[model samples]
Target: MGESTAPILRVNQLNKQFGTGCRQCNEVGSRQLDKNYCTACGTVHACQQISFDLYPGEVLGIVGESGSGKSTLMRCLYFDQEVTNGEAFLTPYKDGSSNLFEESSQQQRYIRNHLMGKVYQNPVMGLRMDFSSIGNIAEKMIAAGNRHVAAMESRGSELLEKVHIPLHRMKEAPKNFSGGMQQRVQIAKAMSNNPPILLLDEVTTGLDLSVQANVLDLIKHLQRELNISIVLVSHDLGVIRMLADRTMVMLDGQIVEQGLTDQILEDPQHAYTQQLVHSML
Candidate 1:
């Protein structure tokens, strides 16, 4: 069969509930939980599956209110945390297989180092705060086995310029930069290795509108130029509409709605999704 229309980043019956002990063989009482929800009262579900077909050069937005499991799902897919059950496949167009859900830690490490890139919620989450902005990004490139890694001395200058940072400030600590600039640095770092997939979690949360627009535009520009698949974790509808080709709406740890951006925006199917759409306007 050819590729299914679903998505390259496929989640098959994926479920995650934060609790103690193994997925199977754990006693319910010892595992702390009033319900399926986390102790924080995040929602829980009997069957929470997250799947989408992320063809090269498309962005998928995962949006929902706080405690809606957007971050949980992203972290699960990113391999920062384990899924309760099911699989997440990260298939590349020209690659042999996705295997993001592979059992081998070595295989996971291989993909984490080269096949995937991440932008976490906090600006510094994916960056080395102690390092200069450019060095932060360059270190990732070098670690990815760029034996003769081009002197980031020049490339870093160019990237800072591309992201609208002063080229001369490439050597400045990322901490010296404001929140917005820190976010930009994180973006720069995420793009350094040029992974086929990017997991962006609330990338513009604290940015001003102008900076947010700039960052969003930079992402759009890079997506086109790099032809990378992006999974955006955000609460902003405007950002989602502008950046996503499709959207996944989660509620109570379950996907209430999912489909093409226009479909979900114009005619949301679920009650929760409808509320999200109406609230955006």
Candidate 2:
């Protein structure tokens, strides 16, 4: 759980806006609209002035309702979206000297391949539906320069087994699997490279309660076994409580509060956080 130490990843003044900065946008920004959408210039501030540190083996949970920019933050960090402003430093990348946002495309590709793993809320976004479960896991391993077919198969099989996916189903395509199974395949693929950090965006969002419990338990087990830092984003406090060592509460495009998971859940200080905690009661 990292306890107390320097962070493995650091983000400073991160911002992501989907529009040009114009006088109209300035006026709208000055008005401080509660929603991210701007009525004047039609810009969307998906993330604004976000900053955080994620220590090794620590699970940092980001919780917010739909359109709250939690997913956007994950996308930006994973290089799925470009950052409008700010710097991100990953300890293993370039010795944490250069901001990851400023890296070359090739460097970013290498970083994503070897250093970080991501599992999106939608399996469609994370898995290649046409690819077999083993093939999907192999794709990430190949990206990290794995070449031996036998070794890849062994590693892939091990990961799938860890996630409770049947060995007989390893050659089956994810499209043929159930939603929970597809998500498990995604998790197995994300862990293929044994990355130091993992980003999970609502990984249990649409599952049945029983299925969700299984997936969540798998995640907790994997975290302990892998000792990887994780940034978990979910609207469900229960999920956060089950997985996160620390939690951050977000609203609109900004973080309203952050602290130890228990502190944030049990003694919510912000009004929105209080409302969220109350609803869970």
Best by lDDT: 2
Candidate 1, residue 145: CA error in Å? 1.6
Query: What's the lDDT for candidate 2?
Result: 0.92
Q: Candidate 1 on 30-124: residue-level lDDT in tens?
A: 54443345444443432356555666677999888887888888787778877777766665523435445655776666677687888888875
Candidate 1, RMSD to the unseen true structure: 4.3
lDDT of 2 by residue, 1-281 (tens): 43557789999989999887556544433645548777777888888889999999999999999999999999999999999989999998878888999999889999999999999999999999999999999999998899999999999999999999999999999999999999999999998988999999999999999999999999999999889999999999999999999999999889999999999998999999999999998
| Clash list (residue pairs), candidate 1 | 6-53, 7-52, 7-53, 7-54, 8-53, 8-54
Model 1 quality (TM-score): 0.85
Query: Native-vs-model 1 lDDT?
Result: 0.76
| TM-score on alpha carbons, each prediction | 0.85, 0.96
Weakest 10 consecutive residues, lDDT, candidate 1? 20-29
lDDT against the true structure, each candidate: 0.76, 0.92
Query: What is every candidate's alpha-carbon RMSD to the true fold?
Result: 4.3, 1.7
